[model samples]
Target: MKIRFLFILCISVFQFISAQTLSPNAQVSILTIGPGSSLNDAFGHNIFRVKDPLNNIDIAYDYGRFPFNEPGFYLNFARGKLNYSIGKSNYRDVRDFYKWQDRTIKEQILNISAEEKQAIFNYLKNNYKPENREYLYDFFYDNCATKIKDVLESTLKGKIAFHEPVAFEQKSFRTLIQDNLDYNSWGSVGIDIALGSVIDKTATPEEHMFLPEYIHSFFGIATHGHSKKQLIDNENTLYEQQNLKTHNSFLTSPLMVFFLIAIIILFVTYKDYKNQKRSKYLDVILFFVTGMIGVFLLLLWFATDHTATAQNYNLLWAFPLNIVLIWKLKAQKPWVIKYLKFLVIMMCLLIFHWVVGIQMFAYALIPLFVTMIIRYIFLIQYFQRSNSR
Candidate 1:
């Protein structure tokens, strides 16, 4: 009878223990990781770290994870329809991964009542469920950093007041992104090409939290409650990135390659001019390439779900009509000369746009732009002389 009573007592104790909540000693911290050399890692990362030694719970939750096995993964990513999900990982494992990549990791311990902590913890738990995990990933609006911002604001019921960083200054979204990217890098060039004029608008102070570093900065200055109590109890550096030299080959850089191509185009154009002849082959190649690029830009703007590709001004230089008139380049038709003149005008407009900062163009494109202008002028003069003959 005593053994049966003891078993009942043990069962009750186990049930009671299972029902217990997190201890008051529990801490929730924001983990901000520094950027790496890769284009994908240039924007850095944000994560939630929940630590409870008494309950033996130490885990990091990341909203940046996406399933590689999802149907049409590449297709969805290309169309801006990719779904990112919340993933839980051991804190040590996440640290080790960043350490291996030589990226710095920092942490900010959040200050709040134990009840608020519990609420936030419970909310994360609910959000990590399979059904609730997935969300549409947008680079500018709803990325990993923005997710942290939204979650904190939502769970706190608008009590958290995010102040502008001490060094905050209003800047266009494109400029802010360019600060993190190398101007001469292929990544920067591709971004300048793919994204349109929309990102050139000035970002609001609150909107700067889209980047992980901005999130870390703004959250540090954040306050809560009517008394303006501080939201961060402490800040820490988990790892400092090592200063290791990375070798970059200059031969493959954009400036060098584009300059060479521009020189070659100029040399060919000069040769044609001296002979009083037009290079139909050269015109065909240039027109085809530029027209194809323009077509691609149009597809990205119209067919794709990507919001940043709309209102692209690169179309001014790479007009799609160039392809349709490929056959007409051989004839000295009046309309052909008129079309060439129109191209020359569009190039001038592109220059005007660049000078006024309507949209930032690639610096490496200067030589190419000059080359295109000279070629178009030569083509116009050639067509005029041919039609007069």
Candidate 2:
């Protein structure tokens, strides 16, 4: 019984195929399944598609040979191949006044034999295997997603569907996907080149760091210092004449702030000591306070100039020092408060550095700001816990 059904189905398909004439010249509109299969009718016009044999995918449909004269077929028909094919097509639909261009098409047709021309037409008409047809769609969707986007646009009218084939074999479908053969490669290449140019033009003074984003957003380089560390040797003769003087000036400017903060902290501790008398020993406070100063010194060193590469890395040593110091001062409370006050002052200076002249600051303030924030959080947590206790 199953065999009988299969035979009937084959017979029915052959009848349908026979009903369809080889007019490759008939009304060029697409019929969903591809140049050959009719899926459904819309707007009383059929949408065409080419089927994928391997993936069960059906690409968008095209109408027909575009009357074989537009820029698309303009070349083949003008070269006489299309004209000859049209003459060969039994479809009575061939227009009487059809013409081809001289430059793109007419000359090429003279070179091919009639037999070869027929073979070409036959291939376009019948022999385009489902696998090869699969390639066209893959070429568009995978490699030329952009072009596929352009052609699938609505403005071309419904007649463009017939240009597609239906049902390609599995191997052909995958082959097209693997091979990227289209306009995207060029587009990406152009973008990369443009980005390289930006990197060349706008590298930072301290970094001279190559950045690709500079191409897309030219101004990004201006505010681009998310984090940066610059290293420049001060061993040169210019160091003694310039950087040495600059370093000395930086060392002194923060002196007033340091003294003022220290005095206020000492006053607070003295008041606490008087309230509790000998019960409030200064050991804990002194230990914690010294740790804060050590941290502040590192920040000061980094903020002195834009080029602080080694200063930043060497600053990492401060961590182990911090762990040891905190353990030693574990019992200190008053000292911790005084140190917290010192950190608050440094935080203010960090912001000022960002605003005054990041370029002159060489943007060293970024890390200083981060360190101050983390330290500030620790101070806040300690105060909150102490107040509750």
Candidate 3:
């Protein structure tokens, strides 16, 4: 209890000191952290830092902090209603956290006047209040990085003009996201299955600032209002990431595993075809898996508030009706044959969609798609023979 009391007392003193007026030596900077190995860290992070040695004030503001302990965490995340908050932390603690993760950290000192810096610092302090902290988090429009960009723009109030970075080009949201993900990894596959055609549209140059590295590049070249002066006073790397050897298991790679499954399925399918026999187990499992995936996509589209999931075209291949077809395969109903034909047509449609740049499916799906076509064709022939017999 004494330790807790001392901790609380220290925090109170720190807050009191931080709220004091800033001296001329006070500086506000942006900290950009590079990506890490995990899926969650594929995209980098952006943070606001305020330091005043005169007042012994040094703190970092993080806008990506979410209230995971709040009620309905899972439900709200799925419904796209999760709220993130601006969290204040010790600057050294924040730096150490990223350093421990081996992520490179860079800081950009702003060129604004001390008064402007004070105003920005005060605004951040006010925003960190419990009542004002939480904000609706949007992946494309209002993520952690965008919060920093938007906050600076709003606080500066026409005092800054963000220019397009020389290294930037207009790319689609899906392409930008996929650049940080391996084509055959589970994260890539899951994202491809969840998001829809809306992400395929090309993003504007300004829209690219949603990523942290882009924010760093753009802000470095930004100009002061009505003047050609640069917005950044100085830039320096705070911590450089050290090189580390990485080893990935080849057996677990998506391409290797999926191709093996495809080969086995095709071999069994070919044997069944030559013997004029059907593998009821294989058909049941295929229908069940595809149908379940289709059902999940349907739920994400209609039941959830996820905007990017609304117009998904993966249903063309998953085919939700396969759930019912699982049992219907035994009877070899006439309509079931037509349904298999429709499935084949839908696969063709998926390929057309991919070609036309409507939506980009996972590259690992190639082997699975080939297996699907072969098996569906074999099933059609078997059904036709049974109908004739």
Question: For all candidates, what are the clash counts?
Answer: 0, 28, 0
lDDT of 1 at 91: 97
| Tens-place lDDT digits, model 1, residues 1-389 | 99999999999997666334678899999999999989999999999998888878888998999878978998998888899999999999999999999999999999988887777788888999999999999899998999988888888888888787776799999998999987777888889987899999999998888999999999998999556999999999999999753635668878778899899899999999999997778889899989988998998899889888899998998888899878787544778888988999999999999889898788888899999999999988887888778
lDDT of 3: 0.89
- Model 1 TM-score is 0.95
Model 1: lDDT of residue 159:
88
lDDT of 3 by residue, 104-190 (tens): 999999998888898889889999998999998888888889998888888888678878877668899999999877777888888
User: What is the lDDT of every predicted structure here?
Assistant: 0.88, 0.29, 0.89
lDDT of 3 at 330: 49
Where model 2 places Cα greater than 4 Å from the true spot, the runs are: 1-324, 328-331, 358-375
Stretches > 4 Å off in candidate 1: 1-20, 244-247
The stretch of ten residues in a row with the least summed lDDT in candidate 2 is 101-110
Q: TM-score of every model?
A: 0.95, 0.19, 0.93
Q: Number of the top candidate by TM-score?
A: 1
Note each model's CA RMSD in angstroms.
2.2, 27.3, 4.6
Error of 3 at 243 (Å): 2.4
Task: For candidate 3, list the clashing residue pairs, or say none.
Answer: none
**Ranking of all predicted structures according to lDDT, beginning with the best and ending with the worst:** 3, 1, 2
- State the RMSD for candidate 1: 2.2
